[model samples]
Target chain A: MDEINLQRQSSTNDELVLIEEFFAQLTKPKNLDSIRDKAREFCQRNSHLKIALVTSGGTTIPIELNTVRFVDNFSAGTRGSASTEYLLKTEQYAVIFLFRHKSLEPFWRHFSSDELFSHLDVNPETNQVTVCPSFQPKLKEVISEQKKSENRLLKITFTTLSEYLFTLRELTMVLNELGSKAMLYLAAAVSDFYIPPENLAIHKIQSSEPLRLHFELVPKVLRPLVKFWVPDAFVISFKLETDENILLLKARNALKRYGHKLVIANELNTRKHKVTLVTEIDSESIQINSQNDEIEIEQLIVANVVERHNQFIHDQSSR
Target chain B: MDEINLQRQSSTNDELVLIEEFFAQLTKPKNLDSIRDKAREFCQRNSHLKIALVTSGGTTIPIELNTVRFVDNFSAGTRGSASTEYLLKTEQYAVIFLFRHKSLEPFWRHFSSDELFSHLDVNPETNQVTVCPSFQPKLKEVISEQKKSENRLLKITFTTLSEYLFTLRELTMVLNELGSKAMLYLAAAVSDFYIPPENLAIHKIQSSEPLRLHFELVPKVLRPLVKFWVPDAFVISFKLETDENILLLKARNALKRYGHKLVIANELNTRKHKVTLVTEIDSESIQINSQNDEIEIEQLIVANVVERHNQFIHDQSSR
Candidate 1:
């Protein structure tokens, strides 16, 4: 309960109070290097499928060599990662995730009740068992921790768009050889434009010079990709924006352009938002609205997405 | 280059054709199990760090819940595992990536471009190579991966909202001990509504009933999370949708609701989209339109985010 948790958290500052001091300490030598070997080891061990297919972290453009690849994306990996979870629900599908900085925290155990169990709490009014018996070391805790799926799927992270693209192109071939069941979901903040070839290394490296990275056109993945990779498998794409009123219109065009089974269209202002599912089956957009806490919108979508996929599988089986 | 790559692209349906026939043999093992092991190993090796900040693939919610959390989000990392590319960019962060089935193709080779280069070809019809020659032989490839000053930080990836919540809660304590110097970006598709505890999982797994999962609020990372982990380091959140023509109106509400820096807002339905930024300074909203692609949008937001963080760091140094 927030009531019990509040006792410990009451003193923690909610506002950005130490932005300067905290950030400065990070630059210190002691801060530059930290132990991530455990996390990396985790990625390497549980990955049932070794292949990785990333959409990077931004929107991608179709049909242009004079295009740019996103160095970064607004996509911190909410939807794509969630779907990745569903995809990982079974070993039949192996996943590779490359995410942005802000997006990596969830994977590290920051907000689970398990984490709360470890927090230290001391009753100031009276030394009391403010913590419940369940709080003490118990089998339930150990089982929860062990039955803990020990999520072992290779999850990689990325910040720039080029890295994602270059990685994907090759991944296509690998998955192609692996099976006819390969899939691709164009999620993330991929860019339609990339910094010119000449400037890629320098500009990306320098991190200076007015910072006017051009919005160049990126190659279209729909058709050529279909012709090239696992043509028989499924491929999904995305179209995002800040506007909520015109999702249908954008989805129609995106479906036509990408030919992906599901085109997810949504407004991009709050992390809590809604989505319009654009699929070819009926061309009717299914709007799903959500909030930040992720109780309502997420469950509906999760159950539906799983059911939808299950239906697709079921229909295939019957056929 | 695309034109040349296009020309060099062999019109060979050989691979696809081979896969099409093999499709019927679902039992035909493609040595994927070994690859899966390799992938898992990758995670295990990288799984070391006090605070691992990772994001899945969706948006976050915008409200509060039980005075604790709220509902929200849409991105499911059908493509998150490919986040390996981010690690390559800079060794500054530690990462563990678990991906979705649909996203494996995009980030397959990011961890090792040599594998990608092996798949390249020079179309007989055109002298140009379909894959970049500098990245040839896959064997000769050198990882030019950058570790943006933060790569050494440990990281992890989750597929479902539940998994994300579980892992997030676990990571919170580690970060708390280490200090609130990191950042969290709730950018995964965390389902807003969930199936109430017991029945929800059953309904979904057993395929019973119309799959009615009620809204049992997930924990809130955007608000209460800051109270524990990375409170001082910068945090960035996102909003995605197909509507919201008046960028300022949408962005203003986002800032007021979710306390994050640089909210990137855009129109999800338009081919030519625009992103409005919502930050501490431009709280009202500053739309950055783009007929090009998301890179333009990414650059705009990235620049501002970098600047803000840099400023925070600089201020700390001065102090």
Candidate 2:
């Protein structure tokens, strides 16, 4: 047991070194300071309201320094965006939405180019544009809700994996001031491997030759996030898998390693309809009534998470 | 010279086998039949108008069969969309725009989400939504142009490399009936390499180990496109390079290899402001006069291309 402990310590030390090198080589995002300021102001302004740092969409790993090519994780930000809308509806939480640029946004996801254009009417003589009568009610509701949540919602966009990590760290540190009232709902599909800056090509990779690539594991930031950054916050991380057999086991392992409050375990194909919430003590599955139902699974997921977060806050205060 | 000829013949034979295998493994795009029918109907209806197939945006290469991860090329469809609008302005051309899903569209590119919403006003009393007066003129112009070109323009969308290629072939064959009047404007930033379906992982690739990937060169579809599919069509291919020194040489090489009508060569950094048009006998560079010029380079590029196309038709008729 002692030998095993020593080996684990050595592995952790190596990881620390890797993380340090990773950050050292990364160029800080250009809008880091402004985003940090926005997040700080949001947290301070909503001191009474519970703050949720809801990360959405997928992060990209560039194969070239000039970034003509990149490896991307597949996510439309559906879960994160839908969950944000639900959380805002509860009136108890202020959200910092750190999302991928051009991915779906909360209320905006309902309108596609065709849907928006099809419902618009143009009065050529008056030089006016109006939403058709049938679409006005839905548009008005979305617009009003958007206005109500304007002050409570802070949006910060990131494109690359490095940018995402840098912003996530900065925001997490800022939210630490909130103590037990903060929640980290990490739903972004971050790339697990990346070609580091030094190894990336300076220009476009030519098509003249067959391509070979080697990528190193992206340093696991969740460890430092949970253990050091904001241990008092109610942390929730997501586990998405293609195979059902390993989904719960992976979620349980993540909980053991990170010591986070909950793991939202989901299979890729059925994720939109069902999810399993795995806490330290037990796991519970949540599913929509029917596949054809109009309800989003995020509606149920956010409610359950909110209840658990409330319990965590209450437990802390009692202790 | 004999030895070189033998080697070239062998290489060509190998490439043919690879192309055959590639298509054999690819699944046909689901909407291929509908898109083909649309293209055919447009061609038959507008037989007198010249047809231009303008491909835009970038194709993605899936790393796994389930496609949780992908390698993507960087393209915004700016050049293609802008060029299409300019082509339509000529009034003598009809465009079949084959584009990446969710990339910029011809007239719709002018307005972003924030731009669109900021100009919108909600009226709760009458249950109405209207565009603000200040933004009315621009909206009117875009909407009018969109309506005018509704019959002349056909839009088709693809996301993955296989889908792009399959649809491209099907569309090219359908456009073949138009003969020399058909102009192929190939501008899409297609991936140079891809992981074959047989070699791709069936599930999500585990993150426990460092990733090593080998990608085969995507077969040169341009050869078969020019030589077999649409030999009589006036084809214009684009060559993009980061290195200025190799740009023209590569463009010339492509013309010689594919026997296409023209090659539009552009350096990666200066593409927005300048491009060189390369034909069999000579090359000409076109550039916007000033950095702050409101005119898009695509306008100039399309005008020059149309002039050459006109001369080609005249020469053909004379022959």
Candidate 3:
């Protein structure tokens, strides 16, 4: 009876995840072609396929222009995108990249776009275009999203903090239904505070001078994962530093705050790329580096990320 | 009076926020070249400039790939380039662009060299190159770090998230030393987590198996306010998103995170370009829509950002 109930639950959950084409199409589209390619390359060749769900990009507080409200930052999506790409290079487990906006497109295009410079604009005055004067943004850069339908290396795009929150929440819900098939990579640049607009019209209509906006902290996404969501699942969360210039201080605090599997941290003005991976629950932290003259930073990041995913897969298989 | 401090602060702050070049090759440079251009156009006259601060290119994370360990990203320093042009557009702020790689000239030429693409291999039978159209690694997209003295833009090319953090830190330090005013816009994609391999031995590195990389988050350099480093300043940040999802969540989240006085949030992929001007604590958030044409999201962002700065000035004058 227990097994039967679990099976039914899984069926319903997959339907919900797959059925919501609106969420995928309207805001972010899943890169089916890439996913199919990934599926073919990684899963077909290697039977044991595990995945680390990685997310990146910035968040925002929604408010209108006429009414003085809200705050936000432009995260180039470097960490999240870099980490996801790095994890994929492992070839151990296929990666599920869930991201939002301009940050992820470049990576996908970099990997898939046939030519370079296809996206860059040309100057009318100098008549100069393309970075290399040779490479172009690739005519095939905008290959229809259709091509990626069968791909296993799928990248789902998203924008706005709430969209990401909903995404995380929904994915977590699916994970419970799937009975823990994948690990969670909590590297998304989620905003600490969110402003719940009191009244939409009143706020927008009352435009005299500078308006005031109030906010409160959003609920913790990862803490619940270990506590309520899924105790057995592997989890990793990111901690950004602003106050205590100390790197470990921030990472330690993050581990305590989220209770994830690992926490990564770096310091300011490091000439070369650097990251500190802090393992939660008593395991020692590992330091990863990408050299100034070595492999690109993003690939290295993906590599480590995948290694973690593989560890989980091996551990689960052992069990 | 309070009003006097605001305007005086605006002018005084402008000096430090603008770029400063001490290469000694150029006699003098101006500040905020875009604003200067506007001033000149408004007066329809010529204005002699003194100093130009050039911030060039985007950050590169030099990670080692396949033992050779060289890789890069898609930042062309176009935004910074436009910023320089805008500075020169005004002739008010001598333009000095601290740019990243691939965004400048000599560096661009370096990429065009045959030596760079010599690695491209072709099959004699098929006449098809293994990595055709472009064989060079993506990192070559990074702009060169070399600079010329006479250039109006002061370009500072960098790669890797660490380098970006370092460059900004050093630049701000220099600004403090010279007491240069500035209109600093927080643009460019900075990598967050890096492989923290500061102490890894080169020979000990294993090539075959997956390398377990632990990453720790890096600290933000902008933490130390320019007021402390280079007092009296103009600073602006960029935020991008799509409107198909939830805009309010994004808008409010951004305001809370960076604490920027003004945020320029736009919805792409829509019939009309919609931009919301956000502030930390403002009288109101203004939403601007222009279905008619592309009115310059870049400039519009700059203007809204400037409005806050202008408000500071206006309040100063009133006082």
Q: TM-score: which candidate is best? A: 2
The digit string of per-residue lDDT tens for model 2 on A90-179 reads: 999999999999888888887876677767667656657767788888888888788788788888899999999999989988988888
Of the pair 1 and 3, which is ahead by lDDT? Answer: 3
Docking class of 2: medium
Residue-wise C-alpha lDDT for candidate 1, range B162-209, written one tens digit per residue: 455545544554444433234444445454334233322211011112
Candidate 2: C-alpha RMSD after superposition: 3.3
What's the ranking of the predictions by TM-score, best on top?
A: 2, 3, 1
lDDT of 2 by residue, B130-196 (tens): 7778887888788888878878998899999999999999999888887788899999999999997
lDDT of each: 0.42, 0.89, 0.47
The alpha-carbon lDDT assigned to residue A76 of candidate 1 equals 50
Predicted model with the maximum lDDT: 2
Give lDDT: candidate 3, residue A50: 60
> What TM-score, computed on C-alpha atoms, does each candidate reach?
0.36, 0.95, 0.44
Roughly what TM-score does model 1 have, to 2 decimal places? 0.36
